[model samples]
Target: MTGIDFALNHMAAPRLGLADFFALARSLGVSAVEIRNDIAGTAIADGTPPGDVERMADRAGLAIASINALALFDDWTAERAAQAGALIDYAAACGAGGIVLCPRNDAASAAASGDERAAALREALAALKPMLERAGIAGFVEPLGFAGCALRSKRAAVEAIRDVDGAKAFALVHDTFHHHLAGEGELFPEMTGLVHVSGVVDASIGADGLRDAHRVLVDAGDVLDTVGQVRALGAGGYRGPVSFEPFAPEVHRSPDIQAALRDSMAFISGGVARPAA
Candidate 1:
């Protein structure tokens, strides 16, 4: 494994405003960050304007890695196209490297034919690639590992991207939490753009029962083998940021978030092995 490079995600500290979130990333010595559009009264949510977001990040000396996501992106409807266009425009304006695209992860989505799903995904990628290329932004397609998710494997995303000849404009988000839930042995670190790291330490719940709310910082108790996942990604030539994306309310409500984040970073960095000299 190579040395790990860490980044921060807004979900790790959801209560913080845009400026404060950037400050947190800087405080942890992380210069890159992923921002969210779902948070109310925040940059994208309050319509704070993309120019303002860019300026705010510049002032903080942080690179906006991505706009957290464009949800249900695989279906590729006209509405989704408009939504994607708006996010791509914002990403371009805010100097973001990419937009994270999350697929539909619901029972209804699961009911769709595999062929139908693949066709829709390919169509969506074909339509979005030109737009992303024009804006000089990469599309980070994150396959949800959940049973209900439409695209549950990184391999599926990779195949779709290849089908659309979007290697230049598309990449994958290798999420450790999702990977564990997905039960897939495949790892496409070469095709990855970002790595979302979080741990599920609750032994009471089986893997199938795990939810986003169960996610927290990696530690001695983590059941998902987060360190091993990082090691695999690194050994496979992935050199991107391993961003913290804890969704547990305890993490969100941490009275001393800085200390908590630092501890998690230490645990992750210390656990993953370093490559040979």
Candidate 2:
């Protein structure tokens, strides 16, 4: 069997409460999970105490891989700093290893010159470094593949992290969906802290037309080549968490999510073990 370290993102089962969510992960034999701040009426949003989150995770034998994200991270402002600080604090208190940082993905931010955008990213990373260091947590910078995203290139993100000497405080999240959407060829496996996997089997949708609503569990029909991506990352030295992050409403509403996830995990594992043609 291939040594694939599977993890679960809360998005995989958004409707489940923290307790059931943690239980679900454990039931899948997945010991790692990523929680999100954006999910309404959830742990972070519902004001679940960090200690409670920690205790619940402990009870379930799960590691909190990350708190999903700090949005618009590259467009750092005083308010952004505050948000980052709060997230970092919460992540640390909840015994999470890191917090994800998402760059602004809007027209105005994306319209900036490449140089300008890179500079802004560096500046933000520089500002976030010390706070992450103090909190003893890494910041996983997730570059969206959407055209309008300010930071669309992983290479550019790695460069910025190096420019700010923030390597110790930051790592990349190589999302299969975003990597495919971005049409990026390079894979920075050694620098990746997490991997978000999803599938889009809608054969008719073009890259630009794809949205979160279209993402579903990975299967043989996956158009994103998620299995190939996972194989490449594993071959490239990234023995990190490959977390399920399907955002389709149908998946969230699955009556038997456990079975669906189990099948997806088996497919990925079997695919990865097969010899390349």
- Which residue window of length 10 is worst by lDDT in model 2? 1-10
Q: What tens-digit string does per-residue lDDT give for candidate 2 at 1-277?
A: 2588999999999999999999999999998999989889989889999999999999999999999989999998999999999999999999999999999988888689988898889889999999999999999999999989999889999998988998899999999999999999999998999999999999899999998999999998999999999998888888889999999999998999999999999999999998765
User: What ranges in model 2 sit over 4 Å off?
Assistant: none
* Candidate 1, number of clashes: 1
Q: For model 1, what is the error of residue 239's alpha carbon versus the real structure, in angstroms, after optimal superposition?
A: 0.5
Top of the candidates by TM-score: 2
lDDT of 1 by residue, 70-171 (tens): 999988889999999999999999999999999998777889999988988998999999999999999999998888899999999999899889999999
Task: Itemize residue pairs with steric clashes in candidate 2.
Answer: none
How far off is residue 163 in model 1, in Å?
0.7
Candidate 2, position 239, lDDT:
88
* Model 2 RMSD in angstroms: 0.9
User: Which stretches of model 1 miss by more than 4 angstroms?
Assistant: 274-277
* TM-scores, one per candidate: 0.97, 0.98
Model 1 sits at a Cα RMSD from the real structure of 1.7
